[model samples]
Structure formats: structure tokens, C-alpha cells
Target: MNQKKTIILDLTGCKYFDELHERIRIAFDFPKGYGKNWDAFWDFMRTECDAEMVEIVGESTMPKEFLPQLELMHTVLSDLKIENAKYGWNFDYKIIS
Candidate 1:
């Protein structure tokens, strides 16, 4: 079996939702024309991303206004986990302090 790969994304430098999305795209090595939006993120993660685990770091440094977006991102990841399980694709994610 192939070894699992873990990916960590630090949000310390992100001041806006766009930056957060950009970080995700870069970390996942998404396509060059990746759409920087929540829907697009969900689509790519469910269909293309191969990371066994994804960790979110340095979130406290991000802007307060981005709280909603942050919450929704977690929601997306959680939902993806369920779908992955059904397909026999193991995956997990977490936010770290």
C-alpha cells in the first residue's frame, strides 16, 4: 500500500477569503485555473485531492471577518470525509492551534 500524505495549510498570512482559497489551491496543487470559491474547493477536494489528511494551522492570526468562511470550510471537509468513506477512500482533516 502507498504511504499516506498529510498536508498542512497555515492561515497566519491570510487576510481575506481569497488568500485562504489560494493557499488551499497551492497546497493541493490544484489546476492552474482553479476557481477560488467554496463550491470549487469542494468539487476539487472530493474528486481530485489525494491527501490522506489535511491540517489547518495558524488560524488565530487570520482576520475575524473570515470566521464564517473558516467555519464553512470545516463543514466542507467534514462532509467530504463521509463521501470518501463510502468510496473506500480514507481521508481526514483537522484544525490545529
Candidate 2:
């Protein structure tokens, strides 16, 4: 499945970037608790945001949004439902065929 793309919100003077980063980091790592669980992504956004600040992006399969919660690293990531199927790093290099 394709990963969900994110919308960048330029918080030029926002002072909550670090807190937001921690929140998102916890969520992404422990999706069930602090991460973007399928059941709770929209729920949290709806409750925690105003009507204009949050808008759902991406396809139905991977819906993302612009969260004005305050952070640069707290962007969207693809959801893999399986608990054990964690996302890992990628290493790519050019190889002429």
C-alpha cells in the first residue's frame, strides 16, 4: 500500500514544536496508545482541532490531515494494521543493470 502524504503547516512562531514532536513520536511508535490507530485518528483530530485547521488529505485508504498541534516531525505515516509488521528504514543505491 502507498504511504500517506502530509500537509505542511508553517507554524512560524509556534512554541510547542517540541511537545508536538514527542506526542507524535510516541504515537507512531506505540500506535495503540499514542500512535495513529485506524479507529482513533479522525476521532482525535475532530475533538482536538477546530473546523478549519484540520482537513483530511490522501485517499480513503490513507487519510491524512494538517494538524496544527505544533511540530515539524509530527507528519503522517502509513498505517500497517498488523502489530508485528513494524516499519523499518530503507537504504537505496543506484545500480546499473
**Which candidate gets the maximum TM-score versus the true structure?**
1
Question: With candidate 2 superimposed using the best TM-score fit, by how many Å does residue 55's alpha carbon deviate from the native?
Answer: 7.3
The residue-by-residue lDDT of candidate 2 on 5-85, one tens digit each, is 332333332244344343433433333354434235434443432222222221222213424331122232222122113
TM-score of each: 0.92, 0.22
Question: Alpha-carbon error at 43 in model 1, in Å?
Answer: 0.6
Residue 57: error of model 2 in Å? 9.4
Q: Candidates' lDDT values, in order?
A: 0.88, 0.31
Error of 1 at 66 (Å): 0.7
The candidate 2 region of ten consecutive residues with least summed lDDT is: 88-97
RMSD vs true structure, all candidates? 1.3, 14.3
State candidate 1's TM-score: 0.92
Shift of residue 49 alpha carbon in model 1, Å: 0.4
Specify the highest-lDDT model's number: 1
- Summarize candidate 1's per-residue lDDT along 1-97 as a digit string, tens digits: 9778998988876997778888988989999789999899999997889898998998888878888998889999999999999989889998895
